[model samples]
Target: MTTALWLLLYGGALAWLAPPVLRRMTSQGISPQLGVAAWLATVAATLLAWLAALLMVIGATTDSVLKGNVVTLCLELFGFSEHTPIAGRVGSIALIGVATLTAGLVALRIGRCLSRLRARSHDHARAARIIGKPTAHPDVVVVEADRPAAYCVVGRPNAIIVTSAAIESLDQTQLKAVLAHENAHIAGRHHHILMVLRALAATLPRIPLFATARHSVADLLEMCADDTAARRVGTRPLLAGLSALAGHPAVPDGLAAAGTAVVARAERLVTPTRWYVQWAHRICLTSVITGMLTTPALIQVLCHH
Candidate 1:
């Protein structure tokens, strides 16, 4: 019981502390990819710590047949006391029921979110294909809208939708840069990342971390795509294309070329920071990830025995 309490505290502390540190590290020029990894790892570690603590609590109270022996053996190995107070046993049962309910709700919420997102994406892509003209490139199509929009819809054959106005606005090189950005989004499977984060955020609105992380990861993924596009087509062209498409409206269930943190991304390209491959940045990222994950595991084990 004491060990479980400590583990719960540890998880809470990590959930509260990690976001600021991860945000700072990303701002300090760690690559968006590493930033995403660090954030996701922190979230996972916190959840794992809580889950392990929950299992420990249940093990202390449960003496049922099939699972009881295994849990009892593990608890004994960890030096957990055999006898739980009557009150503690009752509390553990309640906690188990609550956890089960919460898991079911989260699963349902995520399922609904995924279903809606996929439907919207498919519908939008189908509409775009019907109305938009094909380009020289196999992956891109130009829509006849005056509003200069460019976003990619994920599907069987991922499609990049660019407005005719945008095509007219940008030079050939700039246009290619925009296409490259959309291509990067598709190639990176960024939609999957956003979908998971967004679903979690929607499901756990009370947990500010999920909401914060969803927004942060969305921005970072945009930066990741930006970096790829910049490398494919030079920064100058990419920057120009982004400028041309500034204030672009985001499409539902779509990754827009210039829809996320445009000013920050542009600044980054203009005054490039140290790349993630540098030893210094790598060390910083490695340490953050290790410390965040290891601390929780250590607490779960060390606090028990």
Candidate 2:
């Protein structure tokens, strides 16, 4: 019981404390890929900690109930009587009930968010396929819109949609660069990661961490895709292409070329990376994630013994 309480407190503390630390670390121009990994790791570790605590509480309650019932039955057989500790029983029941209810609500919220996202993606993809013209690139589709826009859709048929105006505005190299950027989003499965984060944020709007993480990680993922596109096409062309498309509208169900943190991403692309500093940041984040996940279990084990 003592172990369970400690685990619960530790989990809650880590959940509250991890976000700011992660934000600070990631803001220092660490590798955006590493930033995404760190953020995901923090969320995963927090969930693991809470799950461990809930399981511990459930296990302790089950053990107490079985022991109390067995002892009472044995005493009654000998013409004696014993009562279970009402306080402990009630407390255990309350904790278990609260945990169950919270878990159920979270699950339901995630399910709803996922369904809505998938439905929207499907609807948009179908519309794009119907309205957009096919291009030399089998996966690329050209839509007849005056606005200079490019975005990727992940659905029944994963696609890169570029507007007619974007085609007219960009040179070949710039167009290729922009196409590469959208391709990076598709290749990296960034949509799936965003979906998970969005679902969690929707589920826990009150918890600032989830909502903040959703937005922060979205920007980081864009940086990650930026790096990939830059690697494919020289950074200059990519920057020019992105600049042309900057401030273009974004689709809620798709990842747009200039949709997220355009100025910051441009600055990051121009700034040179310090491999040594990035390595150090990676090591620190890895250590923190490992500690967050293992500390609660270690405490429970120590208390048990």
Candidate 3:
């Protein structure tokens, strides 16, 4: 029973939490401070949940024993006795169950919301029609829009959409650079990463750690795109193009666009401190991954028994 309850609680929590956490971590772009806060929150929440589950397991075992249940024999092997308070044990179990259920439901709801939003974006036929055919390049799509933009839409048929306006606004070199950036997004499968982080955020709304992670990934992706563009068209032209396109509106959710967050992205590109910023971003991402993977392993090793 204890095993069953533990499995139910932990499994449910993870299921509820994973999608949004992963999605958010990869999406909006997070700062190091935000990532640290998120990691700490995740650690704290997991610990609290684990402790709660443990107490409930103990309480449930106690209640069964005191009620003269046959399970008492098995429980005695684990060191619990029949003199424990049945009512208190029952209450503890009930409270833990309720709390777990509530948390799980919240996570599920958030995931569902994000999923729906993504689905709506992907399924919009008008946008798909506007995007025309999928190109040889996984990231590049020619969309029929009057405004210039670039964005990566995350999914199985993930793509980057560019508008005629973008072409008109950019010189040949700048246009090539923009295409390189979009290609980088597709090659890196950045959209999928963003989706995962977004889903995780949806699942665990209370965990700002996932949100920070999401932001960090998003920022990295942009930097990656910028790097790709710089390699081809030179940083100066890329920065010029970015600056020229800074105020362009984003493509709708499902549609891909070239320049989203144009102003900030341009600023980052122009800033002399770019290399330092890139280094800091990489370090933060490393820390987040390390913390996420290590904490879970440590908990399993130390607490599962």
Candidate 4:
């Protein structure tokens, strides 16, 4: 039990330190899609490490109080060796306190985020129906706004919204590119990704990785959508559309920023690196997926060792 407790703690600490490093490593690799996968894997692995530690804390503490010793229960539950020491009461209690605090914070953060998203979604739908008219494209609605802005209304039966200023500002091909990019955002379900990262960051702002992960994931998701749109509508049109929309403010409670992430996306389009995918990037992505999926088995093997 003692070994398991320390192992879980060390695992979580190691996971907590990993996101920024993985962000750098995957950024040097291939697609933004690959980077997104790595970031999601880091989040999954970190959750597993922390949750395992919290459960071990509760299990050991409860068993020690009820059965007068926890080693037997720990051995049966976690497959720790017979020689493994019983968990000390003091450490178990401390871990339980920490776990309880973390869980409470996480719950509160999630509740607040869900409330905000629901309200924003409702407001967006109302605006779309009232001020925006359905377009010939069927999936798009043209909002009669004076600013060169575009963003998707994220919810079930997602809708893409374009301002009248956007229509007056862009040509046919640029409009297609804009629609394609917004569609990519909806098709990729990028808002949900941001919501999870935002919730984690809200709950654990002191953690370096969560802060970095929130920003990094937001950028990667935009890149992924840019890649998708570029492939469909051609990079030149996409780049042109992005350039045209620069300085226009993004919609409130939105996933993509019109001006903020455009420079990097434009540079990526101009560079033309679609054919630069390498075996190294594929291996890294696969390894992250494997590590996250195999964590439980690896923990068991470590206990046996």
Best by TM-score: 2
- Weakest ten-residue segment in model 2 by summed lDDT: 69-78
Give Cα distance to truth, residue 34, candidate 2, Å. Answer: 1.2
**Candidate 1, clashing residue pairs?**
none
For candidate 3, the TM-score is 0.60
Question: How many backbone collisions does model 2 have?
Answer: 0
How would you order the candidates by TM-score, starting with the best? 2, 1, 4, 3
Give the alpha-carbon lDDT of every model: 0.79, 0.79, 0.57, 0.72
Tens digits of per-residue lDDT for model 3, 202-304: 6766665456555555655676677667777788788767765676555445323233455555665566455676567657656755664465445445434
User: What's the CA error at residue 238 for candidate 4, in Å?
Assistant: 0.9
Error of 4 at 174 (Å): 1.1
TM-score of every prediction relative to native: 0.86, 0.88, 0.60, 0.84
> Top model by lDDT, which number?
2
Question: Regarding lDDT, does 1 or 2 come out ahead?
Answer: 2
Using lDDT as the yardstick, the better of models 2 and 4 is: 2
Candidate with better TM-score, 2 vs 3: 2
Model 4 lDDT per residue over 67-116, tens place:
66644334644465455554566655665677788777777877797678
Candidate 1 lDDT score at position 246? 91
Model 2, residue 233: displacement in angstroms? 1.2
